[model samples]
Target: MPRALLLTLAALLSACSPRVLSAEGWSFRIGDAAGEVRLVSRQEFGVCSPKLVGCTVPLGHGCLVMLDRDYFLNGTPRQRTLLLAHEVGHCLDASVLEYGHGGIGAQGAVYGEYYRPAVEGFAESYARAYVAVCGDNLAPLGYGSGPACALPDPRTVRVSLP
Candidate 1:
């Protein structure tokens, strides 16, 4: 094919590219905990940087957000969903700090381990609690900072879905 034809083809493909849904500082509530989801990536994971698999960028009051969307991982749909929830957890934690609200991470040691930082613990615990509410006790263990596992009972924890 000629270069001109190739360029035209590229332009057409780019124009037809599907748009990915994204939100900035989207507010949400899970049970008694309420906060904004800083960044929620649905089909992609960790698209922010080339080196990162995933991350949460914190802006004042939490607006600007970027995650590691660099490369494709051999992640299954279920695992990607978990990663998405984890990133949402980061957003929730960021809002809690800015707005002075009682988000899920406020409960120290309840959702996270003492050895790690609160931010990571927040994401990890939020993921666990998310799965807890869904009753996914059979989820694969040894994920996140605290070796995250689903909580014992769904009734013990409250989760809000929208």
Candidate 2:
């Protein structure tokens, strides 16, 4: 999408806040029809937005997701889906809303890795578990290679963001 249209869409997005689900792992889904997400696809430096590929805003019970279309456009199909999944991870992951200071998921850095296990780390782990089901191959956003690519027994897997 063009930058103009992307910005227009951003402006046209609902003013209401996002309604995210507060479930563990990939147990819950964030419905599109419910307007639980407000996507803003625009020009960005990689998934390098302030929040990287995207950001999730917590709304108490749950939270809303705001996306950077750049990731969707620039990333591979696998990367795109993983990006959305990553955002979903942010919405449902408690560590992000509370500890990461309102879901600053991998904002320009890796999270959930052994070195930096934190809020964003949990969210990336959520996305990582998702790709693992597909097979052994790793697919990180844009870079096309993920970390660990497996979810732990208690769903506390840690792998750095792409």
Candidate 3:
């Protein structure tokens, strides 16, 4: 192949390749749908938005979870996995509501107080469940002192879809 063609092919192949993360007998891949979610989140939040330091944005079929380079470099493997799993939970519709938003007064109160917490709780529960199931494998990864290992009761998680 011509040099230019070879370079172009390489770029194309790279673009088509899925983003993958693997550890402790668990592996995850972000496909095209998830890539779109990440693009949207990057556009909306920009790089390292303080507000989105540790947040998840759910798209229709997927979600974008932010984990700054600092966290990836400094956090324990367990923390990294827990964060990813929590966001994955959101992508998988673990929350009662499809999205979180509300106005003031009674409805707003529900949206602000109840809705957001329910979703967060659900996501945390999902992460915790994963940790519980894989505790033996994940323990060495430094998940010893986090919410991932000590998850809340799923029954307590309220869900009011809108």
Candidate 4:
């Protein structure tokens, strides 16, 4: 396409894009909010060893966010979903923080042979809690940090997914 036409199309798309506020300092599109839990691409993972397939942010920019690889070539859907939710659990562990890259690296234990189970436990708990709530209707959210699976029992305060 000609430069002028490309520029015009870009401007049109930008104008058509939804404008959302920075809720709690992070904002996403309507599609992201539509799902009970947001499933983001692995490119979003942005940290940790390559061998590690999933992650959740417990603090800083991505706190409470969970992500897995784009597809489960090396994992099952259930496993990937649980992994992503677990990462979100880490983010929800405490109030989100604004740690720099070095601080986040230290917290995530990227540099050491840390007891990963201790950290992974949170993700696991979150996944279990989520699954217990949403049950089978959560197929569209795919395998990642989903709120559907973590719904509180009817007697609890957890909100129902849309």
Candidate 5:
């Protein structure tokens, strides 16, 4: 194949491939349901703070999950998977609100707190559960120590994916 054709093919293949977020002993595949997962710098992870590790932005149909490349580069596979799972949980939970569960910005309603510890707790629990189900040896990183899989009652609406 010509050089240009080869480059085009590579780009196309990359576009079609599922984004893989991997660490030392574990890896998670970000599927089409999540839209796109971008690995960015800490400064890019959030607004005015290069120290943030990850974030999730909800899109109409899917969502965007951004990981801090620097954090992951220095962290263990367990840490990476834990953070990725937490962000994914945020996206998944937000989907419920986007689908007209309660109303616009229903996630805030469910959070129902000054700092939204409940929301963070749920994400942490989700990460713990996911790691357990996958049978990975790594211990829960952040909120895993709090609850096993505790999600707020108000935010526990059923979501059907197609």
Candidate 6:
């Protein structure tokens, strides 16, 4: 999709509510920190399956975000931030490296070496990489040292703002 269209969608998503803004901020920051590859939200990811979480589709263009109302409202800010970052990691996986063209079968495997484990492994690796460089000091945002807060390379994941 065109960058302009993507930005427009992001703006529309952000305008949905305050939660969207917060989520967008997290996505933007993380994307910028990681360097290269753009991250944005879509209205719907086009696939709804049990295997994928947080609007993850195996088509692999980017992640489609859906902030659960309960989590956004009741969960701590740190929790929300981590969740957003995690989902964004999945987006990065789709758009950049593993842009799988296969549908549900290729996307969601029931029994194979290339299914759940590989997908989660890649996502976790990306998250860990981000944390390692960025540090877990999201304290200013009222977040504490969660799993993502203790990264080792707090410098590599910095994304440049446009």
lDDT per residue, candidate 6, 10-39, as tens digits?
Answer: 465445433343453332323322211222
Per-residue lDDT tens digits for candidate 4, residues 3-122, read: 354334334423432111111112221121211122334444344343455543332222334243344435665665455444444444432222122122222332234423434433
Each prediction's Cα lDDT score?
0.41, 0.45, 0.40, 0.36, 0.47, 0.40
Q: Can you give the lDDT of residue 121 in candidate 1?
A: 56
Worst 10 residues of 4 by lDDT: 18-27
lDDT of 2 by residue, 100-142 (tens): 4233334424542431445656566656666665343333221
The number of residue pairs in model 5 that clash at the backbone is: 2
Clashes of 6: 14
The parts of candidate 4 lying over 4 Å away from their true place are 1-44, 60-66, 72-77, 96-116, 136-162
Candidates ranked, most accurate by TM-score first:
5, 2, 3, 6, 4, 1
Give the CA lDDT, 0 to 100, for residue 161 in model 3: 33
Question: Candidate 6: RMSD over Cα atoms?
Answer: 9.7
Off by over 4 Å in 1: 1-50, 60-74, 97-115, 134-162
True-vs-predicted CA distance for residue 16, candidate 4, Å = 30
| Inter-residue clash pairs, candidate 2 | 18-64, 20-63, 41-69, 111-121, 112-121
Error of 5 at 30 (Å): 7.9
Best by TM-score: 5
lDDT of 1: 0.41
lDDT of 4: 0.36
Expressed as tens digits, the lDDT of each residue in 16-50 for candidate 3 is 32231211122222222231112122223332355
- TM match of model 6 to true structure: 0.43
